[model samples]
Target chain A: MFRAGEVDALIHLGVMHDPRARPAEIYSWNITGTTKLLEYCQAYRVPKVVLLSSANVYGPRPDNPQFLTEDAPLLAAQRFPQMRDLVEIDHLVSTFLWRAQGVETVILRPVHIVGPVHNAPSNYLRIPRPPVLLGFDPMVQLIHYQDTADAIVAALAPGRRGIYNIVGPGEVPLSAVLRELGREPVQIPHPVARPILSLAFRLGISSFPVAELDFIRYVCMVDGRRAGAELGFRPRFGLRETIHAVDEPA
Target chain B: MHTAGVGLLDRLHKLRGQVPDDDIAGRTQALVVRGNEFAMRVARWLYRNYFRASAFGIEHVPATGRVLFVANHAGQLPFDALVICAACFLEPPTPRLVRSMVEYFVPTVPFASYLFARWGQITGTPENCRRLLAAEEAVLVFPEGARGISKSFARRYQLGEFGTGFMRLALEMRAPIVPIAVIGAEEQAPAVNIKPLARLLGAPSFPVVPYPPFVPLVPLPVKYRLYFGEPMTMTGDPDDDDDVLDEKARIVKSRIQSMIHVGLREREHVFW
Candidate 1:
């Protein structure tokens, strides 16, 4: 209500992703905060809105396609309560997008975003000699922190409106990224690592939730074809460059 | 008979120094599996002398570029994928490797996971498959997934539910789908009994077998026959209707099933 005439575009990137926080707190903050923001946008006639969504919404499933698109089911919330808040926010924003006449909404789902500030999946990407499951080497899809900033900037440009999967260039094995960082892979047997990681988390030794370990065990890649086609946004860094720039294990 | 094991190491020694493009992990992982020389050689030997595997339609496989080989998963483990990989390498005009899509739980095994990556296996993610295909690498997928490989001995050769992801990927990537039927592998480690402990064992199927407890769990030498049918041309968007996806998958399944019938009629014996 305050910036009625001044603000024409709104970039919604604020999220409370701390797993330690109470789910109820996270929900109200995201949901209610977003509603107020949308209310302001509506009151102020902010025509363009861009949201930074996550590829994690596509949950890790044995049957998940190698790369997910924007149309893929947001199944992560079904399993991880931690993800429910993001999905709810997205559902609300999307529902708002269509119901309102003048507002054009763009939702972008990006893969593991790594850089100065570490997200959930990025935290796993940095630690030296992280625990790797014995027989699995899942593909790692990442966007540089700078490139993510660039994507958000691109999303706010005038005429783009729709859901898009924003992925970085190139694909490599997670083992490759670990090696590039000079970290030794601590191999853990799959059947056993599940509980051990959970216990480690419970013991306050590890920050990553054990549930998200499935990403490392399986594929969590997303196709960025739509973004490339529509937004005209291409990641400046390739897989090698992003990995080298993001995590310096040494 | 002399072992080809040592002999294969000799070949890998010559192909060494492919490290220029590899990242730190790819290089380190190669050290673990020795560029996957030993396992590949063993699989090659198994496909050649052990299984006496013969191929019928490798010509359908493109000498270059991305092509999807949809095969039935059997033999309890991925012995079927191994034999298929062997066929691609051993009897080929172009000695390109076929990257078989593996399960997420595969990395649970420490040593084997390294070998899988070194040997050119990628996790079965559409994005992974799509990338490999875009790079023009040959990718193989078992649409039946763990279900087919773990099927009961009595239901052997019965194709399980065909996952439609491969079909959509085929359409999306615009790669031709080659339906392949592998015979004899179903009997390699036949599912004599699917143990109730499959869940406890954390495997798709824990089959009670005929082998004694102390006996080495080597897959019995079964004469193998592989049939590669014509590649089907895919049309439509990858984001097509679920029914369309199901029908597309069924079309490929029926084709493979028919090929299995042909292979069954032609296979001289399960074991020579």
Candidate 2:
């Protein structure tokens, strides 16, 4: 499909993130697939490219500031091996962005995309009784899937190119979000919950990976000012509506 | 269990009614709004009856600008931070919600993780401090950090080596630093730190008081006298040399140290 000047833009959203999937399969699909896509875009001279990357590349760290800028280092893969493919893909695209000067590559790192999706945050919220780390309720940021779509659309505009952290309306405590959704959270001690969650994942009883426990335990929020200033992007969903989006019929 | 959440709401609403118009200006959430209401109630009681805390020079804290309240931290627990927050909230002409920076380990702790954020506490990151200051909000920072909080009883009232991070933040944000000296917090729990025990537990500092229950979980009800000094406006490059930053930090440290001495002299009794 690489006819010169045939494709104006390429939107790369083909990252596979199945925590239960074999690591080799995920690596090939994510890394090799992104490499091939970027090669095609570069060869085809695709004028614009928008890559959908989650803000989770920064990882949920105990020392992270409440709002991380776009320039913050991607350190999620350090602790969670499952995140390696995603982080590697991000690095690959970022390298392409710098080298392929002809291509306007835009990376949209949206915080926890919820709303009518089968993603982890949405799926976790859908649970009637989600297991919460006992006493750990970090402030969480979520972006509606539709709002994420809006951000991608914004990035497609002419002259929009750098990494952007697309945020939703606002941030709220995880417990408050659960309360708003009316979900009863089972409090499990951190030390024991890890083993139980790991066992559950192995038995195919739960889809959540053990490493993802950090999401509920620490703050991994980002600053969306760059998106607002550059892309003129603002979330259309309110905090209440965004949290309630998981319950919306898919 | 469901009714318990309702009971908590009822109490929170009653507490909300008692506090002045809430002033969490920027980046607020539902929990923070409600949490401030509850914290205000607890802070009032602790300031008045529990600690009998007296706050002076609270007027130095600007009502409508970004300000950093640099205070001397003490007590095995962080009752010192609580008392300083209480002083800023209750004594100021207009109630200000001080977003104090907390320790990294705080987020790992169960209830403290979210509860601290809800009550306007943030992790001690320069970025978090910069953002809060940029939004014209009040932030409380303990330059002494862990060193000051975990000081043993023998070294109580003697200031620890101040960290230079807050000075850089104040300089970068151009926010005035209001030095605070909190007397009586050092006497709240006179304890010695067992380093080996702390290392074995993988905790910061293992403090053991000479009283019943050993661990200084509940601080003694000693009088908390908060001396808020004039706001010091620092002018320099935030990225200056460490020695340069240290010299400037020493100025604020000495200011707080002098205030602590004055507070100690004015006090007649530790409990009163």
Candidate 3:
């Protein structure tokens, strides 16, 4: 499709489906591939380009009590699989288009995009039961699928050039998400967890990649106030709504 | 007049059969092979650990052979040379073949000498230099020589006066000189102060003192970084006068100094 010019814009999704994947591998696909595609688009003179990146690019940095802004430095260096890759891809796209190609690039970095369509087995729903009840205590910012789609559509409008962090209605602790799913939570010590994860990694059964373990230990949260103010991106569903919807039948 | 003529005639007769003996040729061959093996092992290890070593403007090294690696010398340790060798070996196309000009003192040690000799590392002698270049081998030379290694810690990376011999050799051999600027070596041995006894013993250009106190003992894992600048092609005619050679040498030295400065500026903190 890219070679034939059948595509006007390319939405690079499908990076995190494999949780056991390496950070470099994810970076190559999502970030490097996106940059190459953008270069191709620029070469072919495609005017509008849209990239679906992760708000994890902000990294698991300490939140300022105040809401995070898009102007904040995308966490360029992190131990997370997708975070560093996303930041690099974001930079590569933004710099290439703005500096070299002059193509209008709109980047949407959404945090923990969630909704009913998230059927992937490894989605937060499938995490081992123990952590659910204990409430992992990790602060999370998420967006509903409808809001995600809306943010993607909004980028299509005129003058959406740089990056915007698309976050959900509000932040919630990790334990809350797991508790909502009705699973027991266990606090595995890091030393024990690391070796077990490494062994599982060696055996090739554990869904968690080593890089993901880094993020589990270190939290990442982004402020989407810029996305709200500029793109009018308002999450249609909050944590309560997600819980209710998940509980309800199709 | 009769005595002088007799002496001259005797010298001429002795010069007739001046070919290198079989033992010497065999020794040279053995040295080259050993050197090759040592270089290969070091290169492979560095490749696994810190290979590619972050290079910028490698286009400066000419694609062709007979290029000279002129770099700064820091401390008595040969880390800079080892790094350069490793970096060149790991370069894209792999400059696996480099003949570093080592000090004659290096070969005095049994194991190190054997390795250096095997790698075709020649003493920075004019004869050996010409022979190596004539054989089309890449020669690495530190023009600052002993002066560079003996400098105070505060003056590290600030190149001392480059010895003119490397320039003269390059001009004579008609080789392109590649200026290399290396960082992370000075910190490898933060010379607190040189002991007077070591200097008196002539311990590797002594008194100035060079040894990383924490390493090898406590094994402080100091991060090492190296940079290679663009090759500054010798512009003047090879047959140029001594003045021309001096001028070319100064230019090469200045280029190397600038590259080192750039590397130092770009780095956040030197030690660590």
Q: Which candidate comes out best when scored by lDDT?
A: 2
| Residue B181, candidate 2: C-alpha displacement in angstroms | 1.1
Candidate 3 or 1, higher lDDT: 1
Off by over 4 Å in 2: A3-5, B1-31
Off by over 4 Å in 3: A1-7, A14-32, A62-67, A81-83, A100-102, A116-122, A128-136, A214-218, A243-250, B1-272
lDDT of 1 at B107: 51
Error of 3 at B161 (Å): 44
All candidates: TM-score: 0.78, 0.92, 0.43
Put down candidate 1 lDDT per residue, B1-272, tens digits, no spaces.
22234345544443344444365444554564465777777888898889888888888888888899999988777888998988876665545578999976665455565457667786676777988899988899999988887777789888899988999999988999888999988998765544677677776667666676512167778898989889899798889899999998999999999999988987777896
Interface C-alpha RMSD per candidate, 1 decimal: 4.9, 3.9, 32.5
Model 1 per-residue lDDT tens digits across residues A21-134: 787888889989999988888888888888888888887665566667787778888767788888888888888878776888888888888875667756776677789887
Question: Candidate 1: what lDDT?
Answer: 0.79
Give the distance in Å from residue B6's predicted Cα in candidate 2 to where it truly belongs: 27
- With a 3 Å backbone cut-off (N, CA, C), the pairs that clash in candidate 2 are A135-B110
